[model samples]
Target: MVTERDKELIGALQKGLPLVRRPYAALGERVGMGEQEVLRRLADLRAKGVIRRHGVIVRHHELGYRANAMSVWAIPDERIDDLGEQLAGEPGVTLCYRRRTAPPAWPYNLYCMIHGQDREAVLARRRELAEKYGLDQWAHRVLFSGRRFKQRGAWYRPPQPAPEKAEVRHG
Candidate 1:
């Protein structure tokens, strides 16, 4: 079970670790913990599913990517996995994942985000992708983004967890 200190550590991590050689040590210093303790706590948090994913998140717009497009496809159920992987490998394809298809309403199961400096360049890449994958025969759409807001990575650190009942055992 998570405690107050665990929550504090998780909350601190939402801002990201320091860009230093001894990042854990820096975190530990801030949290009144030893370096090893911070590492152990982070590992424990991951094991307990408190933290789902750990990685560096880049803000593409800040990095000079002026335009972005979400190219969604109505991929066949059997072909989604292979095609999704192939799309992920393409240059400028920043994000790729599958979603549950809402039949008759929305059939787009495979999705990818392509980023570039120019909208036309992004569209050209999309066309190349479609041609390379023969996506014209399949249903696909490249919706160029006009504006972006709140594109930061998720901050999973909650201030306080909701109350829950846990069974107690006495030895």
Candidate 2:
């Protein structure tokens, strides 16, 4: 069960920890906990599978990856997991996952994001991925991003209190 302290930690994390050498320690100070306590709690949460990872999320464009595309493929449903893992292992792939497809219309299920310095390189990498992964047989599309907005970690909100039911007046 989540305790009040966990809620406080989550609430503070929503705003993002300060950018410093010791981010967890800084986060602990913001949440009124010792650095060791913070690390201990985070480790506990990880052991329980509450949080998947603890790391930095960089803005690719700011880091020189000026062009990117969300490459999608319509692979056989049974082979999706296998192919998704393969795509995730590729060098240029930044994000990879499977999505539900709307049949008779939208067909792609496996999706991944590829980043590069320019459009040409991005497209070239997509072509190489198709050839390397034997994805030529499947229908796929590479959608180069026209614009980027809202690139940040998730903003976690505090859970709202459940509303109390009112007693009915017999009169």
Best by TM-score: 2
- How accurate locally is residue 76 in candidate 2, as Cα lDDT from 0 to 100? 92
Best by lDDT: 2
Please give the CA lDDT of all the candidate structures: 0.77, 0.78
How well does candidate 2 match the true structure in TM-score terms? Answer: 0.81
lDDT of 1 by residue, 36-60 (tens): 8888888997899766557666666
List residue ranges in candidate 1 displaced over 4 A.
1-5, 19-21, 43-56, 149-153, 159-171
- Model 2 lDDT per residue over 1-171, tens place: 667787677667754567899999999987789999888888887888766676665766889999989888899988889878888888998888788899868899888889999999999998998888788699988888886674444344556332222211111
Off by over 4 Å in 2: 19-26, 149-152, 160-171
Clashing pairs in 2: none
Q: lDDT value for candidate 1?
A: 0.77
lDDT for model 2, on a 0 to 1 scale?
0.78
